[model samples]
Target: MDHVNISVANNEEKGANVDFDYSQRAQWLRAAVLGANDGLVSVASLMMGVGAVKQDVKAMFLIGFAGLVAGACSMAIGEFVSVYSQLDIEVAQMKRDHITNHDQELAEKENLPSPFQAALASALAFSLGAIVPLLAAMFIDSYKVRLAVILAAVSIALVVFGAVGAVLGGSSRVKSCVRVLVGGWLAMAITFGLTKLIGSSGLQM
Candidate 1:
């Protein structure tokens, strides 16, 4: 009877471990979904706003197409550079850990390996997570109002999502969200302002 109980306990532990692995995988999916959602929401909103101002369907379509193309390329480049920098930081951190471990061994200090491994995993996870949204947002339809809306929405959402990520990683959620939101809006404002400026120079048809 004792053996049976022990066997059952071990099986439960194994099941729990598997469950954890599955849950961890879900984080990647969350990132992907958020990316797509961002693209759709922002672009849609932008399209609606522009459509309100300019009833010329052709102009709106061109503007949206241009925005989508520009946003996707910018996102990709931004993500690549951002992730590359993160990778560098992670490498530096790992190197520091290695040196610390070596020093500890020399001085007969003791610590567990688990902490170092955990840190490494976290850094990699963050870097990879940053890329998913950019890629997903690149799918905005070209030459369509929907494309414009999607690109704008995704851009904003990605910024917000990044803030949420910072919070999840134990940072101040309000601060992170506010900072990202402000920066994102500033960018959108600049884009719209430039578009309007260019549009205004033309004779009112």
Candidate 2:
């Protein structure tokens, strides 16, 4: 089969075709960064929270290690689910547009020329979104906070991130902020609660 290259340019006139590379490397990078971030944040929080209740260095060390492992796994799974969901939505939207445009194309095949391009756009946006939190984790020292104030601050940061993400994605910023912040708080709350419960049990053990 002979291949004919077509250009989809911003201008009305036809232009030379450009080749591009598509890879899963972006998703992996996002996951790695977020995983490390979660490790820093959660372990740091756990150590701090536990330290508040007691000044036992050995206990704090143990709790920190546990938190690091648990948090990293949690982050990886969460990132995978989120990235996959975003990918799914992008695919579904593109599929829908293609289907809608298919009939339009049949009617005017010559005029409907630009192929659907939203999938790549959404993926790139999501990848960048994941990276920000990761960077924050790298910069913020996670070992110092020993109070609920720390939790509150991180929650606010998450809300800001969600708002930015929503804005970038052309979504409702308020809704996104609430949704993301609430989810982060819920996680923090659950972990904090579990720490109290399990820490007591550890003492007994």
Candidate 3:
């Protein structure tokens, strides 16, 4: 009887461990993906724009650094605020559900992420993504070569991020990757084109 009880206890523990739903952590996944995507595209676009106007390695590097810092900070603060607000709303909803509907199960099923966790994830992901382009173009001296390398690096990173996000979210991986790739390309192309156009017209940055 003791052995039987021990076996049952072990099974219960195992079941409890397995009961966690990964989908419940989707909020953090989304925040991380968004931060990474924003970091990649925005820094890549900024690098391309600066490259279009001035290919000075130092200038491009400075601008890229500034963008990474600013973007990461922005992502962290924005994600914290947004996630906190969502959590607040969820909590309020739970209260309403419990008070009005008396649905204890519904109120008790809160699997939301912490605002700090979401914010930290976003900031770290953004920093990681932003570093890719910076490292890719770090050693290249030629402006065209640097730009090409940055584009290639950014494209690969975006595709990977999109695919991972899709897989985690149970969406179509290929479609997500293609969509992110195209969006990234559009951003860079537009930024580069505008910079070149404006620079040529005597508004060089």
Candidate 4:
């Protein structure tokens, strides 16, 4: 009887650990998905906008590279600041709660969000997403084909990101995918259309 009880307790503990790990993984996935989506949409739209006005492959490459670098830096800085602020708030609250036990304090700190980690993750995810459109347009010489390939690549990536996010977040996959796809398409379309219009309106550069 004692042995059976011990086994049951061990099983429960393992289950709890699994749950904790799963939750942590979910949080990471959510952040990565959001960051990637932002990067992909922003860079793709920027490239599409430029492609509308200029068929020069060099121009598109330059714009896409600029967007990737700028976006990654922006994401890193934003994430670092935001996570640091949250960490400060949580630490202050812990102090207010008077958590004096050293071991407990250490555990809490371990569980707290790391600003450096968050920043790195954000930057990496953004760059990963932004690379899709860049690579799609890299070898293609035909202007129309380049734009089509970029759009197709961005659309596929958006769908993949959305599906992964939904699975990890336990949301509706179809809804998530549709929402992300539509949003990406709208962003690219609006940017391209407006840029084309402005370029055609006697606007230089």
Alpha-carbon RMSD, each predicted model = 10.6, 11.8, 5.6, 2.6
lDDT of 4 by residue, 76-100 (tens): 9998998899999999999999998
lDDT of 3 at 57: 85
TM-score of each: 0.42, 0.41, 0.82, 0.90
- How many residue pairs clash per model? 12, 0, 0, 0
- Tell me, by lDDT, which candidate is best: 4
lDDT of 3: 0.87
lDDT winner between 3 and 4, please give it: 4
Worst 10 residues of 1 by lDDT: 108-117
Worst 10 residues of 2 by lDDT: 14-23
Better of 1 and 4 by lDDT: 4
Error of 4 at 107 (Å): 1.3
For model 4 the TM-score comes to 0.90
User: Least accurate stretch of 10 residues (summed lDDT) in model 4?
Assistant: 22-31
Off by over 4 Å in 3: 1-22, 98-110
lDDT of 1 by residue, 43-154 (tens): 4334444544465555555555554555454444544555456556755766667765667554433222223333333334333333333343334444354435544555
| Regions of candidate 4 where Cα sits further than 4 Å from its true position | 1-22
> What does the lDDT come to for candidate 2?
0.50
- Per-residue lDDT of candidate 2, residues 1-205 (tens digit): 1232222333223222111111223444334334433443455456555655565556666676565545544554555566567656766765667656666546543322122222233333333333333333333434443244445556666666666555545569999778766766666567667767777776643
Model 4 lDDT, residue 89, Cα: 100
